[model samples]
Target: MSFDLTKAETPKADDAETETAPEESAARRGGLVDFLSGPAGRNLGLVLALVLLIIVGILTGGERFASTDNALTILRLGSVIGVVSVGMTFVIAGEGIDLSVGAIVALCSVWATTIATQTMAADYHWSVMVFVALAVGAGCGLVNGVLIAYGRIAPFIATLAMLAAARGLAEIIAKRRTQIIRERGFVDFFGGSVAGVPVLVIMFAAVAAAGWVLLNRTTFGRRTLAIGGNPEAARLAGIRVQRHTMYLYILLGLACGIAAVMLMARTTTGTSTHGTLYELDAIAAVVIGGTLLSGGRATLVGTVLGVLIFTTLTNVFTLNNLDTSTQAVAKGAIIVAAVLLQQRVARTGST
Candidate 1:
C-alpha cells in the first residue's frame, strides 16, 4: 500500500494526455479557419482605401473637407453612384454586365417626367408613371436575360447591344432635348433633402439595405451567387440556372428604373444623355469594392465604399477647379490602380 508506482504513473499519464489534446485540436482548428478566410483577408483593400481617401480629402479641402456639410456632400454624391453600383454588384457577381444601365436610367427619367408633368399632374397620379417606368426597365432586362441565358450569347455583346437599343429608345422620347418639368413638389422631393439630408442619399440606403438582405439572407440571392460561382455547377446541383439568369437581369433593370426616378426627381427633367458613361462608373464601383469581375463573391458594403472613393475623388477635384477631362483621366487611372491592386491580391495571396 506504500507508494504504488503504477497508480502514480497512471495519474501522470492521464493528466499529460488531457493537456495535450486541447492544444493540438485548437491548433488544427485555427489553421483550417485561417486557410478558409485566406491570408489576403477580404475587405483589407477597402479599409486601406477608405483611410487614404480620408487623408487626401482632409488635405485637399482643409477645413472644408472636414466639415459636416462637406461630408454630407460626399455622401450625397456617393449615394447616387452607390445605388447603381448596388445592382451592378449582383450582375457582376453573377458574371454579367448591363451596358444598358445608362440608357435605362435616361429612359426612366424621361418616362417619369413625361408622366408626372403631362398626365399625372392633371389626373392626380400618385407615381403611376413611376410604376410604368419600372415595368419598362424590367421588360428591358427580361429581353436581355432571354438573349443571354436562352440564346447563349456572350454577356458583354448582348448587354452592349441592349445598351444601344435602350439609348436609341431614350433618344426617341427625349428628342435630343432636355424636357424640363415645372413641378415644384417633384423637384423638391428629389432634389431637396429631408431635414437637410438628401433624399437621393436615403434612397441609396434603402436600395442598399434591400440588396444586402437579398444577397445575404434570401433564396434568390443564394441562386444568384450559385449561378455566378458556376452556372454549370448550379444546373448540376438542380438549381434553375436559366430562369435565375433571366431574373437577375430583370432585377438589374428594376434598379436602373429606381435610379432614373431619383434622377428625375433631382433634376426635374428627362435628358437623353443623362447617364452617359454611367455604366462604366457603376462597373468601376462594383470592381473597386472587391467583387471579382470573373463572377461570384461580392460585398454590398464594399461597393458602397468603392462609390465613396470615386465620389470623394471627384469632389476633391471639383473643389480644386480641375477640368472635366482631368478628372476623367484621374478617375480612369484610379480604376486601373484599384483593379491592378485587386488582381495582385487575388493571384499572390498577400503582400
Candidate 2:
C-alpha cells in the first residue's frame, strides 16, 4: 500500500474530474429544459383560468356555452367591453390606468345619438355618426394624454377628473334625460346579426386580433413592455417613453369611443348613467385574466376569458334572482381572490 504518493493522487484527481464534468453538464441541460417547459412555458394561471371558465360555461349554460349561437352571443357582448379593455390592456401594460373610459364612451354615444336622433335629418348616416363619435373620443383621449404626460399628473388623478367632467358633459348633452333614438335601417346593422352572428362580434375579433399582433409582434409593444419594466432603462435605450405613453392613452380613448357605438347600437338610446361601473368590470376582467397591473407582462387571451367568466357569472346571478348588492359583493370578493393568487405567484417566483 506504500505506493508513490504523487503518482497515485494524480490519477485519482483526474478520475474525479471526469465524473463531475458529465454530471454537471447533464444537470445544466435538465434545468434549462424544466425552466422552458414548466412555469416558463406559459402563464399557467391564465391557461388554467380558461379551462375553468369553459367548464363553468358548460355547466351553467350547457351546450349553449359551446354552441355557435351562444358563442356568438358571448363574442357580441364581450366585444364592446373587449375593445375598451384592449386599450385598457395597453395602458395597464404600460403601467397606467384610464378611469375616464366609461364616461368617454357615454359622451361619444350621446354625441352620435344627438345627430342620429334628430327628426329633421330623416337619415342617420351610420359612417358619419361613427366618425364624429370616435373623433370626440380621440379628443378626450388627447386631453388625457397631455395632462398625464406633460402636466406631470398621476394617471389616476387626471383620468378621474376627466371621468367626472366627461360624465357631466354627457348628462348636459342628453339634457339629463335618457334620449330614445332610432337610426336609419342600414345604420342599425352594427347591432344586427348576420347569418345569426352579431356584427359586434366580428368587429371585436378584428380588433382583438390586431391588438394581439401589435402587443406581441411590434417594436412598439416590446418598447411598451420595456418601459413598464424599467422606464429609466428604456429611456437609456433611446426610446421616447412620454411619446409612447401619450399614444397609448389616446388609443385607449379611441377604443372607448368604439365601444360606445356598440353600446348605443345595442340599446338605440343614450343615457347619462350608461356604462356605470364598467371600468371596475374591465379592470376586474384584466386582472382576473392574470394580466399583471405592475406592467411589462400581460395576457390578451386571458382578458377574454376573464370577461367571459364575469359576464357568465353576472348572467347566472341575474337568472337566479340574486340582488344587485350581492352581485357587487361577489364581484369584489372574486377580484380580491384573483389579486391574492397573483401575489402568491410573484412571491413564489422571487423565492
Candidate 3:
C-alpha cells in the first residue's frame, strides 16, 4: 500500500508539471505576439514587406526594377508625400485627423509663388518666399487648432471645412490658374542635391529625424501620447489637452508648408489643383506605417516605411504600365487590411 501510494503521488506530480507546461508555452507565445505587435515589431514587418515588394519588382521587371535611377525616382516621388505624411503622423498619433493637409499644401504653394510674395522675395531675399509659405501653413494649422480645441468643433468637420476653404482661397489667389515660379534660385537650391543625394531626400530625412526626436524624446511627445491614449485621464494627470491638441494641428500645418515648398521646387508651379487627394495619400502612409487609427501610439519609423512601400508600389505599377485606377484600388485594400490587422493586434494584446 505504501509503495502504491508513492507511485500514485509521483504520477500526480508529473501530471501537474505537464499541465503547467502548456500554460508556460502559452505565456511565451503571448509574449512573442506582443513583441511582434509592438513598435519595433511593426517596423520590422514593414521592412520585410518592402523587401518582398522589391523582390517582386525585380522578378517582374529585371534590372530596370532595381536600377539606381528607379530608386532615386521612388525617393523623389515619395519625398513630398512623405513630408506631408510626417505631419499626418503627429495628427493621427494624437487621435486626430487633418483632411486639409493637401489643401494646405496647395494654399501654401500658391501663396508663396503669388506675385505679392514672389515680388517681396525678389526685393528682399528668396528666403522670404519660403518664410511666407511656412507662415501660411502654420497660420492655417493655427486656425484648425483653434476651431477644434476652443470652438469645440469636431476634427473631421473642422478639417473638412478647412480643406474646402484653403483650396478655395488658393483658387481665388491664383484666379484658378497655375502660378509658375520665376525664382530660379529657389528652384535650383531646393531641387539640387548634396553629395549626389537630392536635397528633397535630405529634407525628408531631416524632417523624419526631427519628428522622431520630437515624438519619442520630448515631454511634448509624452504628453501627446497621454492625451491620445486617454484625454480625460491625461487632463487629470495635469496635461493641457486642448492646448496640446492645437499644437498638434500647428505641427501638421508646418509640415504642409515644408511640403508646399518641396512641391513648388519640383514642379516650378503652384496651382490650386496641386496636392489633390494628397490627404488620402498621407493618411494611407500613416495607417500603413502601423500607427493606430484610434490614437494613443505613434511610430515614425513605421510611417517612413509605409511611405516607401506605397511609393515603391506606385513605381512598380507605373513601370509595368498599370493604370492609376488600379493603384487607387490597391491602396484602398491596403488601408482596410491595415485597419483590420491593427484591430486584431489590439484584441490579442488585451486578451
Top lDDT hit: 3
Best by TM-score: 3
Candidate 2 lDDT: 0.79
* Per-prediction TM-score to the true structure, in the order listed: 0.85, 0.84, 0.97
lDDT by residue (215-286, candidate 1, tens digit) is 989988888888898989989999988888888899988988888777777666778887788898999888
Residue range with the least summed lDDT across 10 consecutive positions in model 3: 1-10
What ranges in model 1 sit over 4 Å off?
A: 1-41, 115-117, 349-351
Off by over 4 Å in 3: 1-13
C-alpha RMSD (angstroms) for model 3: 1.6
- Residue 32 in model 1: lDDT: 53
| Residue pairs of candidate 3 with colliding backbone atoms | none
**Candidates 1 and 2 compared by TM-score, better number:** 1
Q: Give the per-residue lDDT digits (tens) of candidate 3, residues 1-351.
A: 346776665657678899999999999999899898999889988999999999989998888989998898899999999999999998898999999999999999999999988898888888988999999999999999999999999999999999999999999999999999988889999999999899999999999999999999999889988888899999999999999999999999999999999999999999999899999999999999998887899899999999999999998898899999999999999899999999989899988
Task: Order the candidate numbers by TM-score, best to worst.
Answer: 3, 1, 2
lDDT of each: 0.80, 0.79, 0.93
Native-structure RMSD, model 2: 4.1
Alpha-carbon shift of residue 21 in model 1 (angstroms): 20
